[model samples]
Structure formats: structure tokens, C-alpha cells
Target: NFEGTFNTGAYASWGPTVANRVPVHASGPYFIENYRAKSYAVHTNTPSSGAFRGFGVPQSAIAQETAFDLLADKVGIDRLEFRIRNALQNGLPTATGQIFEKGVGIKECLEAIQPHWARANAEARAFNAKANGSVIRKGVGLGSCWYGCGNTSLPNPSTIRFGIKADGTIVLHQGAMDIGQGSNTVITQIAADGLRVPVHSIKLIDGDTDLTPDCGKTSASRQTFVTGKAAQLAGEALRRQILRKANVSEAASLEFSDGLIKAYEGDTSVEIELTRLEPNAFGYVFMAEETYDPPVKALDEKGQGMPYAVYGYGAQLMELSVDTKLGTIKLDRITTAHDVGKAINPMLVEGQIEGGVAQGIGLALMEDYLPGRTENLHDYLIPTFGDMPEFVNLIIEVEDAEGPYGAKGLGEHVLIPTAPAILNALRDATGVIVAALPATPDKVMAALMAHNEE
Candidate 1:
């Protein structure tokens, strides 16, 4: 087996050289610099290395999150307060040296959790106060992060097909698979709105590589913003064509419902069946396609540049108790606030954020990957049902002008900042600083022994 050590602080940094020029000025003493350090580098000794769930994030997460805990202890500051002081705002620059043009919600997310955090911290402190001689000492922590939604600095794209069939039913051919994120359902909503037709009447053709156009991968949380918008644009193009043929003198705002267009003129209304219109009355039956690509620039030699078209932010807090003697950490509950730009699907967005938080908690407490044997899920360890606690969601809607329907990618961003936040809280609960990953029983025991001796 090949051995390698990844050090983030090794070099000044590489890539997107311009990110360093971006300014970060905050009112609080917490000043953040936009420094784009290399997140990771694959050693050549291995033929391949990657995984589903979280390919590279968990690896980097363990180190950075633990570092935050150390920083809080060294400065003798409340973990959450430190995080709030350094929280990223809309005008602030990112690590990659890019200035967020829109959809920045880091501060809003933290503010949303203020009440929950205050209550939880007080309850945790009071519980720990009574346990004078107990071996178990309870603790909690928090983490935050940012990431781009779609492919950056590389060619990535998505295409959507819209057609007015001979039968008059609006047909949509989506090039990307749903991948369990309800892509099909959302795209249908976009098409229905675009074509001015009922959602029930819109039947989407499954994503087939041969028949469909080149819409990039369904990953990176881009299906909604990219493919969804393409479908909407194509549908609108067709609707405009149909309206031209109706030859109505009066103009009206129209919406599609139940396979008909509801034309409204200041309370005066009329409904018309889309299929009943004369087939050849217009020159064309209306058909079109479109694609979307978030703007991004490649990183330069110093690891700085506008590497991402946009960035998403989140803040999360956790309450837990640790058995100082047994070295077992018990989490009470978690509250999270995320800026998702616009919740195109509110239910779906919440599900994504909550699910990611659970994974982040696992990373902070249990999930650990052995360098040599990466596939051992059982031994590698992950959180189970017993580990799950109450989850309070604080959803923030900040409209993104560049995103489709005021939307941005929420997939990866949900998990980025969670681990660090949890780790910070853990430090606050127990006067211990964990400097490594997993925080397993062995590690916790060692840290506790050292603390006691000191």
C-alpha cells in the first residue's frame, strides 16, 4: 500500500490567482481573507480514488473542522460566536478569490439559529453543571462551508427539449435523469408554466443519450437551475408561437392549467384548449431547445481566480453531551440555517439540507476512512439511527438573479459547513480540543487523559 500525507498549509496556494485580490471587510473583529488553497491533490501511487456520498469533502472536512475547535479554545471565545464573527456575507470574497455576485446567505443562516442556539447551549451548560463527579461530560459543535453547484473551470452543460406534438399535448424530452432528487417532477413544473399547459398534460420523455441533446451530468445540484430553466425557456417559446396564431386583438397574461390557457384581462377571462387550435393556422407548430452554463474562470498559478460562477453558504449548530469517563458522545439535537437562493421545491430543499447535516455530523463524530482500505463501510463507521436527533430547519430564501427562478445549487453546500460547527460546540461543552478525525473512543480517551493530567 502507498502512503501519503496531505497538508493544506504546505504552500502559499495554487490556482485562480485573482481570488486574492477580492476584498473581505467585516464590522466584527473577525476578518476573513479570500485565499484559494488547493482543497486536495491525488497521489499518483493509487490507480483511482473516489466514492459516492462525499468523494473528497469528508477527508478535508475532518482537518479543517478540528482546526476551528482549536482556534476557539486558543482565543478563549465561544465557538458559535467566533463562527458568527467570521461568517461569510454577500459582498465578501471566497477562498478561491471570487466575489459573490449574488445568493450569499451566511449571516442570515447564523441569525436564524440564534434562539435555538441560546436555548440549547443554556440547557447543555446547566445539565453539565450538576454532574460534578461524572466521567461523562457532554459537548456540542458547529461547522460551515461553501461550494459551487455545477462544474467549474471545466466544460459542463445541460439541454432541455420542448415540442408541441401533433396531438397538441406538450412533450418535454429531458436529457438528465432524476437521480432521486425529483428532477422529473420539477422539470414538469417548469414546462407546464412555460407552455401555459396543465402539469398533468405534460409527459416527459425519459433521458436517453441517443435521442436527447447533450445536457451534462445530473450531479452538482444543477438539474433544477440548468435543465429546469431550459425546459421553461423552450416551453415559453412555443407558447408565444401559439398566442400569435390566436389572432386576438387584446393582450393578456396567460397561465397553463388542465391542458388549457387561462387568459386574464383585469378579471375578464377566457379559457382555450391548446390542442383545439388549427394545426396549420401558424407557420410552425412550435419546437425549441436551450442550454445553461454558470459563468466561471480558471485558476492561475497561485491557485486564485474566479473558479466558481456562484457560491452557497450555511450555518449549523448541534447540542450534545459527552461521557468524559467512558469517552462516548451523545448528541441531543441539531438546528441549521441555509441560504438556498430560492427554494424551487421547498420540501426537496429541506430534505437535501437536513440529509447533508446528518452526514456532516457523522464526519465530525464517527465517519473515518482508512487510507489503505477505503471500502470497509462497517469498520470505517457511520452514524446510525441511535445517533440521529431532532433536526430544526431554518430555511432562508435569497433570490439569485442569475439562477433559474431565483435558484442556486444546494447539494454540496449543505454538507460543507456542518462538521466544523459541530466540532466547535463540542469544544464548548467539554474543555477538550480534538485535533484529528473521527474523535473515536480511543482518540477521545487520549485527549481526556491528557486534559486531566494537565
Candidate 2:
């Protein structure tokens, strides 16, 4: 059983929103037959807890993954094996009773980490054994997670508009905000591929309400899956129009070059001059507007529904050393495997994974918010350059049927498994489970003393 609350009653009467996410994400990613979770948004004087990177899913994952580690120890099963036994797969019903016929990669992610897990365990054991009377102890821990791509059981759609200007220029209206997550680059690539045009030829107008259509907000990791699909469809639509005007079949190869659209079918060819066509109201000879909404169903009285069209899966392993005397933990390395369906931009995917790990390390070891006392970076600390460890990201490509070019969302899923993995690693090193978050030095020392006394 799990219970959570997000209090918003203090300002609810004034139109403040409540905790709409706690109940949906409290179950985490695995299936639970007899599980029970209760969540609430009550009135309080403090400000409301709004959506963060992973919404409320990260909180839920912390609770569930920590509990699973403890449970695995109690049952005398290998932690990794324990998770594998309960991981969701095809034909398994989620806690929400949503059963996926395909594209469930939880098991594959778990398997992908086996070699790394074994190596880390061996290295940690060897290091700890040699430490002898030294205060340093090394350990390795694992975490697995799943995340739905879009809004839970709701319609969140994205629209994309692409046009070929009479001046032989291609313009794409991209409404998704980048926020430094590389949305601008990735979506443009998808659009370019769809139009069969060079990436440099496409001019992008992004996030301007006056010029672009609604691609929705950059949340729920929906841009690559939803907005990218819209871009893809718009590209295809424009391509079809071009081919029709050239009187070419789908098999015909088409290219845009030197202000002319050329189509080739074996020994025959046709060319359409860009200047020969009249411009539309949008100032383009060809234009396409398309929208995509992931298939989903609303939740029932029991909170059961097709909450997401697709889910991304991941497993991560953390290796670290603990100093018993100083109550300090140092991370050595992290090995992560993510089933992204397809990586539209591998570099961007790696960046997301690394950034998530940094935050996860902070959440597990150092971050704590004290309202009055902690005012700035000095007090409310985050991971710095010296705090990061070596990272290995393995991109797992399990195709999603509904994703744009078989690509699912990777943003939120990267961080879901991070904090829990670090917490479990702390337990492995010190032989004590720090139930409270952060596992700060004081709390870690207290838990160590308690374990030693026992």
C-alpha cells in the first residue's frame, strides 16, 4: 500500500489547481494485482506543488523502488532478478488495467543491464573486501522504471504546418518550445526527412503564437512523439501533393534542387518549376497542416484506462563508495539502458540521460529544501561538475507503432530510475536503509549507528 497527498485547498476556492497527478502515477510502472494507493490535494498555507520534470512519477518511483529493494532482501532474492520477475511485458495488465499487446520493453531493459550489473557487483565486492579496516565501502545497486509518453488518459494533441514557398524556400512552423532540450533540431530533422529536402533549406519559426500552430506545451515528453508525428504527417502530405502535381507514383524518386522539383521513374523524369506555380494565402506554392493525438481513454471510477499510447522503459545501475567515518558517498559510474523506441537524436538522448542522473544523485544524497533557512544555491544545493560520475548510455530501439518514425518520448524516463538506484546503492554499502529522502550526512550517520548497535 502507498499513500500520497498534494495539498491545494488553501487556494482551491480562488481557482488554484489541485493534485491531479498523484493518484495516476502512485502505482509506478509495474503491474500490481492487489495494490492500493490513495492520494489527495488538501488545503494548506504553503504554495501548491505543481508539475516538475516527471510530474509526480519520480516521487512514486522513489517509494516503490526503495520498497522493492527492501522486499528483495527480505525474500533473499537477487534484487535485479526480483525486478525482472515482476517487470511489465506484453499481455500484462497495468495497475490501471491497461494491457499492451506490444512495445513493452521493460524486460529487455532489465536484461540489457545484466552484464553491467554483474561487473559492477564484482568490482564493488573486490574493493570492499580489500578495504578491511578502512572506512571506505563500495556497492552497486539497480533501478528499473517505465513512463507513459503523454498526458494520462487525456487528449493532448500537436499540430504542425509545413509549406514550400514560391521563392524556393521551405518553411516549417514549429510550435514546441525547445528549452535547451534539442526539440528544435530533432523536429526539423523529422520534417526534412518527410519532405525529402536538405535540412539547411528548411527555415523554422518556433513557439510564436502569431506565426505557428499549436504544438501544445513542452510537457509529458510529448514533443518527439506527438509533435514529431505531426511534422512527419505534414511532410508526407506535402510530398504527396508534390508527387501528384508531377504525375508520379509513390515509387518515384523525388528531389528538390536548383529551384525545381524533379521526379524520376526509371528512364522517365518530370520537373515542376517553383516560379511557375501561384502562391497561396500563406505565401507558399505547397502547404500542409497536420495534427496527431495519441490514442487514449479516460479513467473510470477505479482509475482504469488506456492512460498513454506508448510507454518508455529503462534500467540503470549505480556504483559508488561510502565513507563510514565521514558519512560521505562518491559516485563512480552509472550504466543506463533506455528503450526509447527510436532515438531521433542520439546526442540529445544521451544529454537527457546524463542530466537526469545528475539530479537523481542530488535527490538521493544531498538535496533538501528547508523553506526559511535554505534560500539559495549555498543552502539548496544541486550537483556540480565534480559531483558527476562516468556515464554509459545504451540506446535500446524497440519500435513503437504509433510513434513518429517509431520514436517514443525519452525526456522524463531518463530520471525516473536514477534516484532510487542511488538510494539502493547506499543501502548496499552501509547495510542500512535510509527511509527519508536525501540520505544526508546526519541521517546517514544515524542509520549507520543504529545498524552498528543492532
Candidate 3:
């Protein structure tokens, strides 16, 4: 049984949303049949609480994963093996009672890092065995995550609009906001595939309501899964129009030259002269608009239904050393395996992983907000370049039929497992559990002192 009380702060904001989401995802992407979770949100005299990355799941994960470690100790099983044995598979049901017929990759994610787990743990054990009462000791920790890609059981839609002009100018009106997550690039790549044109050929337009279509908001990691699909459809719609005008089959290869489209199939070829065609109201020879909404079912009061069409899963193994004397933790390395369905851009995927891991570092050790006093960046610390650990990125592809070209939402999934992995590693290194957030040097020193006394 799991119960959570969330301080919603001075106003509502996403307090109710956080309350609703915590219970559904608190189980840490594993199979939990005899599971029960409840959350209560109460107003406090602080700032209003809202979505802080994992939408309250990160706090729950930090507790849940550490609890798993304790349970593994009582059962006399290796923590990694214990998790692998009960990892969720293709036919299992989540805490929400939603069954996925396919696209379940949590087990794969856990297994992907198995080889490293043994090697890293052996090294840590060897190093600590030689520590012989030294202030520094090494330890390894494991954490995992499973997150839905879009709105929970709500109608979230994205539309992509594009057109071909008589002058052979191909313009794609991308509506998805690129809030540093690379929506602008990822969506364009997916659309480019459908249109059979190079990415450079498509002139992209965004942030202008008068020019762009309604591709929906950039939250919940929905731009790639939802907006990308819409972009694909829009490209196909225009391609079909061109094929019809050329009186050619869908299998025909298209070549754009000057202001004309050449459709060629075997020995037959047809040229679509753009100058002979009439422009539409949007001032294009052919224009197409398409929308994609992920399929979902609303949850009843019991909170059971198909909340999301696609889910992203991953696991991370953290190796670190704890300076028990000074309460300073130094990350050695982090090996992460995530099921992204497809990586439209491998560089962007890696960047997202690194960025997420940076945030996780802050959440685990450095960042602390003291309201009036620690309001500024200097007061509240963030992870510096020196704080980042060496990363071994392993990309897992478990294609979901719902995503565009088998790409799922990855923005939030990368952050979910990070803090949990770090905290678990802290425990492994020093044999102490941090019962609170920001795990500052002072708190860690105190915990170490109390443990030493015991």
C-alpha cells in the first residue's frame, strides 16, 4: 500500500493534476498486482505547486526504488536480479489496470544493462572491501521508469499544415512549439519522409498563428508522438494530390523540378505542370492539413481505463562514491537504456538524455529552494559541468504502432529514472537512506553521523 500527501502550496495550480497523476504512476513501471496508492493535496503558504518535470512521480520513484532495495535485502536477493524477476512484460497489467497488448519494453530496458550491473557491482565491492574504514567508498544503484506519452485519457490533438506553390516552393507550416526539445526538427524530419523530399527543401514556419496550423501544446512530451504523426499525414495528403493530378499510382517516384512535379513509374512518366493549375484560397497549387489525436479512454472514479496510446520506458544504473566524512557525493558514471520507439535524431536523443541527467543531479544533491532567500540562481544551486557524470547511452527501440515512425515521447521519460538511481546509489555507497529532498551536504553528513552511531 502506498499513500502520498502533496503540499499544493498557496494556490491550486496543478495540485489536483499532480494528485491524480501520482497514484497512477507511483508503481515505477513494474508489475504490481496487490497495489494500492492514494494521494492528498493540501494548500500551504508557499508558492503554488505545478508540474516539476515528472509531475510528482519523481518524488514517489525516489521512495519506491529505495524501498525495493530494502525489500531485496530482506529477501536476500541481488537488487538488480530482484527487479529483473518482477519486471513488467508484454502481457502484464500496470497499477492502473491498463493492459498493453504490445510495445512493453521495461524488461528489455532492465536486461540491457545487466552485463554492466555485475561488472560495476563487482568493482564497487572490490574497491569498498579495500577501503577498510576510509572516508570514500563506491557503490552502484539501479532505477527504472514507465511514462505515458500524451494527455491522460483526454483528447489531445495536433495538426500539421503544408502546401506546394506554383513556383516549386514547398512550405511546411509546423505548429508544434520548439521549446528547446527539438520539436521543430523532429516534426520536420517525419514530414519530410512522407513528402519524399529532403529536409532542406521544406521551408518551415512556426510561432505565427496566421501562418501555422493548430499543432497543439508542447507539454507531456506529445510533440513527437502526436504532432509528428500529423506532420506525416499532411505530407501524405499533399503527395496524394500530386499523384492524382499526374494520374499516377501511389508507387510512383516523385521528382520536383522548378515549378513542376514529375511522377515516374517504370516506363510511364507524367509531368504535373504547376503553371497550368489554379491556386487555392491559401494561395498554393495544393494544400493539405491533417490532425492526429492519440486514442484513449477516460478513467472512471476507480481510475481504470486506457489513459495513453503510447508509453515510454527506461532504466538507469548509477555508479558513484560517497565521501562519508564530508557528505559529498561524486558521480562516477551512469549507464542508461531507454526505449524511445525510434530516434528521429540520435544527437537530439543523446542531448535530451544528458540534459535530463543534469536535472536529476540537481534534484538528487544540489538544488534547493528556500522561497524568499534562495530565489535566485546563486542561492539555489544547479548542476555545473563538473557535476555531470560520464554517460553511456544505450537507445532501445520498441516500436509503438501509435507513434510516428515508431517514435515515442522522450522528454519526461529520461528524467524519471535519474534521481531514483542517484539516491539508490547514495544508499549503496554509504549504507544510509536520505529521507528528504535536495540531499544537501549537511543532511547527508547528518544521516551518515546517525548511521555511524547506530
The number of the candidate with the highest TM-score is 3
lDDT of 1: 0.65
Candidate 1 on 1-454: residue-level lDDT in tens? 1111333232323212112211111111122563323333433443333333433443454455566557776899866676677766666656545666567777777778878877887777777889878765556667665555665566576777777644455668887787777778777787787776678887778678876777778766567777776777777776676566443323557655444655676767666675665444221245677776667677677645665565566767777777777777777788878777777678888888877877877877888765567777777777777787788887888777666677777776677666666666657766776778667777878987888899
- lDDT-best of 2 and 3: 3
- What are the per-residue Cα lDDT tens digits for candidate 2 across 1-454? 8787654534654222224554565666666788767776677776544556777667778888888888899999999998888888789888878888878888888889989988898998888888869999998888888888887787899999999886678899999999988999999999998887778889999989999999998988889999999999999999999999999898888877656888998998999999989999889998999999999999888877888898888989999888899888899999999998888889999998998888788878888876568788889889999999899889998888898889989888888888889888988988988888788888888999999999
Q: After superposition, how far is residue 225 of candidate 1 from its true place, in Å?
A: 2.6
Highest lDDT: which candidate?
A: 3
- The segments of candidate 2 whose C-alpha lies over 4 angstroms from its true place after superposition are 7-19
State the lDDT at 5 in candidate 1.
36
User: Model 3, range 236-325, lDDT digits (tens) per residue?
Assistant: 998998888889889999998789988999999998889888999988998999999999998887778888899999999999998888
Output the lDDT of residue 103, model 1.
71
- Candidate number with the higher TM-score (2 or 3): 3
